[model samples]
Target: MTQLSSNKASGCTGAISPVLIGAVAAALLVAALLFSASSPGRPSSAARSAKAADSEAAKRYHKDIKPILEEFCFDCHADDVKKGNLSLNEFKDDADLIAQKDRWLAVMKNVRAGVMPPPGKSRPTEAQQRQLADWVKYGAFGIDSRNPDPGRVTIHRLNRLEYRNTIAQILGVDYNTDDEFPPDGAGLGLDNIADVLTTSPLILEKYLKAAEISLDGALPSEKGREFSVQGSAFKGNNNATGDRLSFNGAPEVVFAYRNKNPGSFRVQMEIEVMAAATGTNETSTSPAASGIATNICHFVVGVQSGVAPLAVLLERDFTAEPKKHQFVFDRVWSIEPHVFKINVTAPGIRPAGRGGGGGGRGAAPPVGPQLRITNLRITAQPTAEVRRFFAKDAPPAAAKELQDYIRQGVAAFGLRAYRRPLDEPTLNRLAGEIEQRYGETGLFNDSVKPSLAKVLCSPRFLFRVTQTVPAKSGEPWSLIDEYSLASRLSYFLWSSMPDDELLNLAGKGELRKNLDGQIKRMLNHKFAARMIENFSGQWLQTRNVMKWTIVEPEVLKREGKTAGKPMLTDEIRQAMKDETTMYFARIVQEDRSLLEIIASDYTYLNEGLAGYYGIPGVQGKEMQLVKLPDDSPRGGVMTHGSVLIVTSGANRTSAVKRGVFVLD
Candidate 1:
């Protein structure tokens, strides 16, 4: 049996027990009996009976099934003419069909679906169709239970998107892996295809970095909490006077820092200094100090409440560097209200006698010397809310308590990260790493980051692994344990690790029973959107929308002719991608027919895409379902802007490419 022992199995609640073990001798005895009964001319009379039944089926296939195929299907599917690359000529008997199961299986699908025997052709009667399908289904050379095959899993690393999503789900950190990791190669345009997602030394390094970054983002700081706020709060600096001001994006963000608790604040500004010095100041880096260090542009960092100006750190005047570089302005200030205003001026320090710029009038933006803040990190003592978050995160001081904390924390985290419960050895090794790191520093939370990094970088977390068990009498292909099933279901549906519900079900071995409901629930989940994004993004080549230069239709590359449609911008390109993914998402979420993807009377559209497609009445930026008119050309994904543009050349459509996309 492949089942883990009850004592050895590990998960949140219970372990994955795929099959129970039996005595080897008893299993072999049963196998021998079963084998003898299935084989012809054995000592058992059951063997003769089985052989006779097989002969009877073959006789029926030749006498009944062969004529049926010849009369209806042979015109296009026999001898040299192989329609759909399938020929009845090759499968003269059940033996041929059994040897090449996939060929017959494909035919069976079409035949059962009433898809074969093309339109306006002589089709088989209901009885004949049933006979053909049933014979293929049951009467033919059927499954040899003794020699079952469930196929081998390629066991590849998650692609960049999956890695990102997995990190988000497991660590609560929305880590972006695309920027750091190399683009995963695609197999048949599908990025998640196992064999194509090969790991390399560079990828390992990327994983290592990703682990640390993910942990940093997920974990709270010791005593204080730190987080990255957007520099966009003051991105558009028209006045060029304020030291700090508030505004809004990883995307667009408008953060309001309000601290009710009493504590000093450490605000680290990743600022880039642009020095425009005049030759007046005595302070110089070299002999001449660039001859302009006399009238140096020093930054005034201040805070304000209404018009009453308050200097939080007036003694510190930041001077310009020799070259433009990101300066880390990390300092703790005894400031109140968690609010502040910063004064940024050009050449303000005129030998220590100069005043602020413009004298009440707005300072000109084209002024010399500029300081741009790219990242703003605020660190403050943990509030009650934050303290509650890391109540258990902060380790105890006592030796025994610390060890228990480490064990429990590491096991729980590893289970989540690895997407399955850790075995005893693995659990101990992981907890020991954290304990060792903590022993050196005596800071439990600090040590957890490296432990998390180690877990994230581990091969078990990186790859989709499955344990194997020996086949049983009638259960030769029961290889996917409950935990593995949970992982597979989660990755396919959510593009991440299994959530608690799934894990709970898996732990209790009830996941298989609730699979249909779980599938339905998951398809409607927000995470399922990732499936639409990643799968359709690659397959339809919509992810390449940004790279493709979409010009106005019918407008030539020549500079003079540019009057066909509105200017195609990046927004429109993004909308094009959104269209296909949303369409695919609707198919699964709404439980609509998959055929709708080919030719339907509905699609998703926002005002932008609607305007682009000449469809009226869609009035918002939010993409929503829009039913199409009978004659609307924008019925299905095949006609989507993303697919069409991707399959077309610039200002031209490739019939061959379009055909290949449709056929393939």
Candidate 2:
């Protein structure tokens, strides 16, 4: 018999009762035995048994099910009226659910399929359910159970777009990604719920993929001792039986030399990676972010001389995965020319590809592996610098110093309220994380720096927190935390972090305490500009004009008549954005009527957009507020190229879409 005392053996409702399981097992065994014995000889007994089972099922109200439902379902459905309806409290009798049989059926179906009451919810054991069913059949009554007490819920972090937008707002800079990240998993169809956003292995893979795709290819390159190296080996370790692999690469010693004179050298390389099924190990899901690819390798050119390696003249981590990887490092060395060594390292693992069927048993069979590299060449040296600047020294990592640096950044950018004043505990924890990663990974500075960037990019730092903290009474939540309040004010008004003035006010408890004064001061501050950029821009769909695609061939042909089909150019788009901002700024600063944006006589436009609108002789791309003539169809945001183009369909304008935009 299996002991049920260990915590692991316990059901989701906590401690399991051994007696319950024993009773359920015995009952099932006796019932099975009787059914087998009476088989063909007793049709009456079978009918009676079937009738009895139905009666038992009908008698089973939710109240009869112990501990499990109480721990899980009740938290959201019981007292919280704002959550989903259908409370388990009124389920005293089975007939009580007749009014909502559809809901009952849905619940039963979900329960049988193992989708609800959700994975993290309290799970009932099969034995427990059987025993409960039997007891209900025998006319059992509900026994009052102890209420469950799960720990307090923590806040969910921001999603990726929120992170990027917050950072861009904070820095007063543009940041975007060409690749869209996968949708985050949501509980109850809400990504903002505190408990829904989980940090899993799958989540880390998203981060890794995002880091690779978003990384800027701006590092400078160099040339020195150069050579073409090629080699290959089989998969697996230490001469153990494994799959055979054909591999080729430049010599590992190429990372030891430096370029003697300043000039440009173009080094070109290519690789090919292939996997062959040995017709054996067939049942394996393809590995993600792994296995047998030439692109996983790192290439380096060292500017070393006299074997004293004083400095690394040039270094860049480039991928050579099965395709051509090419780049030129101009004027890589500022010193005299010398023989330089070239080094290459390709790393990969072998496994089945993604979305494969399951395996039979035993160890999986190995697949044939192959990786190749060729077209190695050092073309010529550049006569001048390739990049505007380069920082060779190690960056600062101390917590206090970092805090100071952040403060300086805050001042330089003129932030309103920081989403939150990063507390000492948070800062210390982040610093510890940095030190730990540096020690464990020994990753190059470039890789290590992004870890800090990730920390800053996290939802905790980006989104304004709205957490409730209980007082020292160890009771129900009463007030929000200090950091929480800071975040709210920052994002709400400034759409960014709190500035020094606001931070000082927050420190003195004046910002939140004296609301009117802070609001007035913030209204006057430059941080208010973010409101025009983020909230107004989103509301106006200004950015969408850039990403929106118009595929209507007919419309394309029609528009292609003048200045290339009146496609919204960057110059034209900026004029529209400037027009909106200027109008909104006046609304806030000068207390002008907000309706003026839609009905004002004055409209802003640059030369490109002006000509596109048929208003001739407007020169230069600089935006200026110009008076709208009666002949001009342009006025307010309605006629702006940004709004008009985005609101249009592939072939023509969409009145419904325009109306919806206006309504929103």
Candidate 3:
């Protein structure tokens, strides 16, 4: 009898009752007895009968199985040939073959499925095949049944894209990790694959830098600068009368302001609009269509930055008299430059004959209203109250308040970073670290920076670590926790951390139930387009087109004859890559059948690519969807210039390479 008390165990220090111990011991004894009975030999008569049957099967392997393999499989899988990296010639006995259990299992599956000998190859007799199956089934050379092996996945670090997007979502600030960190390794045609995304000392250093940069954007340390530019400085199309700027239909004047500081800013525009010449017959119209006689100039104001998309800020009608308009933009988080645009259109026009003929006798046609911009100013100033939260020196009363703020901030950030709530211990540890750092460095940002950097470098934030749960009775694998499932779904689709909605759903334990709906929502999001660029770029090998060079001497010689006409230019290459990326994005966005990737009636094209493919109608740098003719050969990705050029050699096309790509 075995003692099963937890206290007696080497590592277990807990106490167990004698009754529980006795129950456990009885279960262990029953399991052992069952295992013994199932073995080749035992005292029971059933065990003896099974041993005799195995012995007979063993004899068949030596006499029948070995002969069949040698006659049929040895030709391709022998030691000398070793086709498909397989060698059966080395197995002198069943024990030797059984040692390589996985290989033999595959052999059994292939042979039994009638795919091993291959088409047109001589096959073994039905009796011989049965003997081989019996040999494997009866445990060749005393080996037990093979167990299924589900491969393990290694811990994956957040790639550059994931890091940037995750930080943006967490902090409400944009930080480009790709610019600061080294490029991640691409294995299995994806940078996000678990086995390939490894951590290193250099990567940790980069993470520290990235954390500091992100924190700085979130909490600025200095006052922002103010600058202004003149609207006359902007380049615009010259009208017939070039005295003033004229916007016929579209706004041509663009004021590009490079914002060096990250804080609040105000933009002011001062302009004088020329009065419109009313016709003799023109009368009062609807209130919306008509405004104050002298004040009727309508202009649309918008702002755009590299970090975010363009946003229209204001649209209103201004007086023709000189006036100043001020617009206030708050919290301006992007470090990238911004473009403030003012789109002004001429006043409503009167019909040629219905309104009144051209001015008077010989007078020229009444000139359309023109806009003259006298001043355009931008002033950036930090919010003093908000800045106090990140101030280094704290007042007596606010010190404790600041400490609480730091704790809450770190906890909130950790929840997003880890994609789950932090435990009490972890929260306390981080808060303590921030307090200690604050004591060492008086600056609030300085203290928070190091603590946040540590969190960013920590394994919990860096890697997607899935907790292992014990499998329930009769189950082969354990199910991942709700939080883990949320993270997996988000990272798989968006290449970023789960949003607050996803986290909330996971907390409520409803993520799995609503997973399909959540996936559709995520696919519809604008960020999901990253999948098209990052995934398809690698899987289709279109990204490599930029790196391809014409190395063939003959190709170079032919290119020398056409000095100005290069076979492949950077513009043409980019257009080709964009074509494939846009096509893939459309397929996902429209939920079209994936088979369209191989054969579709339409593709995206720009002027450069359209010219390259000899297709007419495309006339601009912007890419647009174009329908292909029935006889056109450029419908799918395989026919795209980027794919064709990358797969082809410098001088000529490789039929074998194209064939292999199609087959793959």
Best by lDDT: 3
Order by TM-score, highest first? 1, 3, 2
lDDT of 1 at 180: 61
Model 2: lDDT to the true structure: 0.46
**Cα TM-score per model:** 0.64, 0.41, 0.62
Clashes of 3: 0
Q: Estimate every model's Cα lDDT from 0 to 1.
A: 0.61, 0.46, 0.64
Model 2 Cα lDDT, one tens digit per residue, 1-664: 0011111211111222244334334443453454335322223444465455445545454445535556655675565542456665565554444334455555455565677667876756777555544444333322112311223434434454454445444322222322444454555433445455445444444443332222211111121235443322211333411122232321233322233222234544444444422333323333232354433434444444343354443454444233333434332232233444444333332223323355432433333334343334444321221121112233346757644543343333222223445556645554455455545654323333343344443444433445444544533224555555666665566655555566666566666677678778777777667666655566676756666776545675676753344456655567766767666666666777867768667666678767767776667778776787876666677767777877888778899989987886
| Superposed model 2: Cα runs more than 4 Å off | 1-162, 165-204, 208-459, 468-479, 499-501, 514-527, 551-553, 556-568
Q: Write the per-residue lDDT of candidate 1 for residues 1-664, one digit (tens) a residue.
A: 0111112111111121122112222333453355335332222343454466567767777888889899989999888998778787776565555556566677678877878887888888999998887777555645445534444346656887778777756655455565567888888878888868776657765665566544544453354456565555643234432223211001111234543222224566665655543223212122232243322344544444323456454323345453433433333222133444554433322221333222222212222344555676776432222222245635788989888877777777777777788789977876887789778976665666665666676667887766544445544354567788888999998888888888889888899899899998998788888887877787777888877865564555455665764667777888888888888877866788988888998888889889978998899989888999877877888898888888888777789989998887
Which regions of candidate 1 fall more than 4 Å away from where they truly are? 1-60, 73-97, 102-121, 137-149, 220-377, 380-393, 468-474, 551-566, 629-631
Q: Report model 3's TM-score to 2 decimal places.
A: 0.62
Q: Judged by lDDT against the true structure, how good is candidate 3?
A: 0.64
